[model samples]
Target: MKHLRFLNKYFYKYKWWIIPGVFFVIISNIFGVIPAQVIGHAFNLITENIQIYGLFSGFERREIIYDIFSYSLLYFGALVLVLYLLRGLFLFFMRQTIILMSRHIEYDMKNEIYAHYQELSLGFYRRNNTGDLMNRATEDVNRVRMYVGPAIMYAINTGVLFLLVIYAMFSVNTTLAIFCLLPLPVLVVIIYFVNTMINQKSEQIQEQLSKLSSFVQERFSGIRVIKSYVREPYTKKVFAEESEGYKQSAMSLVKVQALFYPTMLLLVGLSTILTIYVGGKQVINGSITPGNIAEFIVYVNQLTFPVSMLGWVTTLIQRASASQKRINEFLQLKPEIISGKQEKRAINGNIKFENVSFTYPDTGIKALRNVNFEIKQGQFVAIIGRTGSGKSTLANLIMRMYDVEAGRIIIDNTYLKELNLQDYRNQIGFVPQEVFLFSDTIKNNIAFGLDTVNDNEVEAAAKNAAVYNNIIDFELKFETMLGERGITLSGGQKQRVSIARALIKEPKILIFDDCLSAVDTRTEEEILNNLGRIMNNKTSILIAHRISTIKNADKILVLDDGQIIEEGTHNELLQKGGAYAEMYQNQLLEEESQSV
Candidate 1:
């Protein structure tokens, strides 16, 4: 129930419409109750031969019939008209308010969740599944809407209707009314047990459904690889198994629902029998009149109708409860990294790693161990290492993707954790190993970071990344649509476009995490040369596997097993005959052999 507290503000916000809706609901129900009373009164007047002596002493019997019939017709017409109008008004405002509230809540929830994702350390995403996150954002929010809108309104209506019917029954005969309500406690017990089961089963069904969706999404995204490897049949089998699990869970819920309605109907049928039998005996004994018995029957039926709807309403609430729990779990997750408490000043690109050590959350292995390094305001440094040698981990640390367990990272003489996260990240530009671009224009991609960059700046960045010529050759030039994840472009072209995106930011520190690995050596050299010409007096860190990529850097560090084994300029490392020299010689040998 606490999980549903997020909806309180929205419900209160729309109280203007809800208050009027409640008023109309009450008016409609009041009119609805009139028909039963009117019919009962008319039946008694005709059966007992009651005369209108006070109103018209001279009127004949035919005139009396005409007058009673006319009044009855008028009352019926007025009752119908009022009920119809009130119902229309209630529904109109209810729908408008519910839809608007759902939209606002969905929008706020998505934005808050997305913002939290951005603030979380990289380790959180690594541990969670992409499909699960999608489920939380889309399916879970919809469940909240169900509870807030239709479920709430129906519950209110049921309570009001039940109370009004009970009061009407008591006015007719209190003893008979008490006997008719005997099955209510039993019905309540059954509903409570069913609601518990429904909540549990609903959770299982939702979880299985998420797995099915995830399996389909992952298979479609990786279809190219699957086809190349001739594993389509195997993939299909896996998907079928996941789909079967979802089916079984859904069937379990169906079985419970199958029992729910019939059980409610049985209880209602028994209650109706008791009302008819007891009321019939009372009328025979002349303890109550036939007109009173007729009205009591109508009220009893009214009570049963709302009681039956309570079962369906309970089922909806159970489903919503399950979904609320899932959504609450996601919202409750605290990010590993915390943003600054105070405002941050501008950065000056001085980076220092003071004996920092880090271990990824939920894993015991150390990624960086007692590492120390420093870079001044303006220098080009390259970090060269083998796979799993912690080069990318070093880059991630400087960007504050994950905080260090021991020691501090300082930028411009201030600890990284003490600075505002959004402000700190704004000062650094990064091109990741895997490039991701939205399905938008090339010009928009290049100008992504800057809110007010001109076309000239976009062109300059593209030219520096050596991708401007390619864009010009396109049919729509920079305005051309790239398709999903930039699927329309070649691998090298995508990397260059991503590079252009990072370069457009004009940050004080630039980091490239093997972004040029896909391009041919000649094209790579051209982009590197362009970068060197434009990156005047700015700190740059390049992570690359090829020796040629980083040979001209002011300093280079060779890493292995999370430790820096060699640190020097390219010429000095070659002279030392250490690990860096060995790697360089091996690369040279491989190239010579390929040429031969």
Candidate 2:
């Protein structure tokens, strides 16, 4: 309930719908209870003239008495039928208002959560799995919907019906009403305990479901790796184990749930028996008519359905609270990377890393150490490093994916964090080392960032990336749809398509982070030459290991173990004969041996 307080705003927002729904429930219950009293009156009339239907004792006046009795009974049945019809009509209206309001609330809640997810930083994603995130947004939200809809509706209906039935019973005979209701107090105490157990079990079930969903999602996403390793049987056995765990967790809840219906029926049956037995005594004492006994019985049965719904509604409320608590966990999180100065701002391609250092938050790995460099407008710079040498870290900082733990980065003579984050990123074209493409047409994949792009621009970018021939060779060409992460294409083709996506943006700063690793040397040379032609006057930073990829850069920096060991042009590095020269010589030998 504390966690569910977050929904107060939505409840207030849809109050008009709720107000009318409550009215309909009250009116509907009024109709629902009236029929029982009508049935009681008809029973009394029948008792008054039980022998009126006889052909001898009342036979002389049988025709007139029969017509009168038949009409009276018909009128009573018609009244009951009318009452029920009205009850059903208002019930329909009640559902229309309340259930529809719940749907609206569900829509608003999901959108709010999705927007919050978008605002969160990459660290949030790193800490949470997609399946768990999805479960919170989808499954948890749906459970909360049940509380807002059916549980709330039935709760109101039960309260209203209980009051009407109890008042009717008390007016006839208080002693009988009191005696009949004795079991209800005991039922309430049992329900309190059941609700406590339900809340605990519901939380456990939700947690287990999240784990299972995550396991399935991860396994399917990495199915290619699993197949490569030939771990199919092993994965299947693990999946079976996970399924059994889920079953056990589910059965625990189901066991508790199974207690509800029988308990409700037992309490209701006890109330019914007391109503009949106690009312018989009252009739014997001349305190009430036979008709009053019939009325009490009808009223008790009228309470039966609502009484049964008590356990069900309580169960829904418990589950909803548990789910809302989970949802609140993520909603309460403040985004770590806050955007500063939202007014539109742009960069002029001048970037300086002044003693920049950073550590990955998730692993606490220091990937950079006192990195300092300067790249002016229109300069082509390349960074070369061994694996884990902080080349990508530098790129990430430039992109502002993560802020430096120490030192400050200046972009265009301003602090990187001070500028508008969205505007700053928009001016830079960054192709990460690992390529990703959406399951979409090739043209749409290349033209993703922009609001709209013409076909010529898409084709020209593809040609510049040297993937135009490959795309056109396909049956659907640019219109071809890809599988997830572009699995429909080869590795080299996917990399080239990703390059085309960045190139099409025509950004002021182009950072290609080892994007050409999958293509052959000849194709890489072709792509680089195309870049050289179009990339004039644009700040291009190429991070790669191969010398051929960075040999033509205006300046080259070599990194070793998170620090830059050498910085020079290609000729100056050869003269120094340091790490850069050593790498160039080794790569040349490998190429020569391959040719031989």
For every model shown, the clashing-pair count is: 0, 0
- TM-score (C-alpha) between model 1 and the true structure: 0.93
Per-candidate TM-score against the hidden true structure:
0.93, 0.97
Model 2, range 166-275, lDDT digits (tens) per residue? 99889889999998899999888989898999999999989988998999999998999999999999999998998888899889888887987788889889988998
lDDT tens string, model 1, 1-596? 66677667767877775676566556556655655675566556555644453445565765776677678667755765676576667656656665565567678777877776766678877887788878877887777667776777677777777777778778878877887888889988998898889888888988997887777877787787999999999998998889888888889988988998888778878877887889789888887777776677776676666777787778777777788788778677888888876586778788998988888777777888888888887788999989988888899999988889898999888888888988888878899988999989999988887788898999999988989999999999999999878988999999999999989998889999999988898888888888887678888899999999999998898888888888889999999999999999999999999999
Whole-model alpha-carbon lDDT for candidate 2: 0.92
Q: What is the lDDT of residue 29 in candidate 1?
A: 65
Global lDDT of model 1: 0.81
Cα shift from native, residue 557, model 1 (Å): 0.8
* Per-candidate alpha-carbon RMSD to the true structure: 3.1, 1.5
Best-performing candidate as measured by TM-score: 2
The ten-residue window of minimal lDDT in model 2 covers 50-59
